[model samples]
Target: MTQHLHTQADLDRALGELTLRDPRLAPLLALTGMPALRRREPGFAGLASTICGQQLSTHAAAAIWARLSAAVTPLDAERIRRARTDRLGRLGLSAAKIRTLKAIAGEVMKGHLDLDELAGAPADEAHARLIALHGIGPWTADIYLLFCLGHGDAWPAGDLAVQEAIRIAFVLPTRPGTKETIALGDAWRPWRGAAAHLFWAYYKLAKAPGFAAAPALAPVEAGTEPATKPARNPNADRRSRPEAKPAASERLKRAKP
Candidate 1:
């Protein structure tokens, strides 16, 4: 197994090796050249932000948080805990999200969720604990580990942005789902999260040269998930999303026996 690649130098070396292995990855190599890996404090606030960002666009998430921070004067557990549901809702949170925030705050305040212990726990253990909460899911936990905790080997397999970026880069016939992205990204290994960041950055850069970005999605509630979608580009996009409009998750649903 690969040990966690710590430090910016390790990421730099791995990216360099991959690009050299395949000249095709030149753009990725350029965009992510020795990027400063963001390291953040792992705690209730970080995890909560991860949950808030799920399925929402970056602009939308940021806006909501700005509003939320202002709404709750102190912006801590007690403030969120005592907040009325309507108050949170007014800040652009959905009914589901209100419960999620409340649960997280409650758990932390009640001493059920331990931010310090979680920081040191194994990835799997941390993931499991997060999922036990009311609204935390795999994608949310994965992102927390990847960006907030700065876990070297974390991957948000279900992130839409990763799928879309991979599609655009490789120019495939269809959009790659979580499972598909995971398989294709297997070669990236321990540096996959950084790979994800590079792909996201590339998505932004790719849209710069008159390539239309994906349609503007409606503003999501304050704390929501967002998956990024990239428009087709020949130099990139090894695969394509099966349908023109990415299939809606619930719309693709089935009954459980």
Candidate 2:
């Protein structure tokens, strides 16, 4: 059976479990409180939104989706598949994105890619199936699992915000790569989805007023000069090297002479 995170209770449980597994999350929890449960209706609309959101800013995605939704008139798989590319472009979808959207719509219409079936499937299996389709990657699949199907343990380790949050939280010298993020996320298993939410929450809060300087985890970068430079000696450039102090043996020799 597919377990979905529907209530704040689910989020609370996940947060508690995640805290127990990774104490580092405690600081973020204190700073950001419980993360918002970003749930989405599980179906074509959700998948279509994910497709529309690829590489687009939040406002841009919302605008494009709004236009497309209005133009599609009911916005079903068949309509999307039959819609002209130029029409979709006029709705603000790039040609590449239009192709991907149409492909997704066609698959769904043909019953080859059923979002409902995916909703009940294991996260890994569902994720694999999603990525097997054109224009879908690990990040997209993980987003669908977390937000759409509400897979409790879905972790989008490749997400840039999550990586940055991990870097700041862990005090790493640099942002964790996808592999490193995945390894780090493994400790929050069974609640990785919530962990992902927490990271995103922290990412947002850390950028807000008063929290900008909260990331004191890592040391300053290497090769950074001190805040104040030493005063320069104008004659130092022409001055000869200072004489070295004589050793005990040399002093004795000079005394004997």
lDDT of 1: 0.61
Superposed on all Cα atoms, model 1 deviates from the true structure by an RMSD in Å of 12.0
Tens-digit lDDT track of model 1 for 73-122: 66777778899999888888878887998989998899998866755654
| Among all candidates shown, the one with the greatest lDDT | 2
Error of 2 at 29 (Å): 0.9
Backbone atom clashes (below 3 Å) for every candidate: 28, 0
The parts of candidate 1 lying over 4 Å away from their true place are: 1-14, 17-27, 31-41, 122-125, 210-257
lDDT of each: 0.61, 0.72
Runs of candidate 2 with Cα error greater than 4 angstroms are 1-3, 212-257
Candidate 1: residue 249 lDDT (0-100): 34
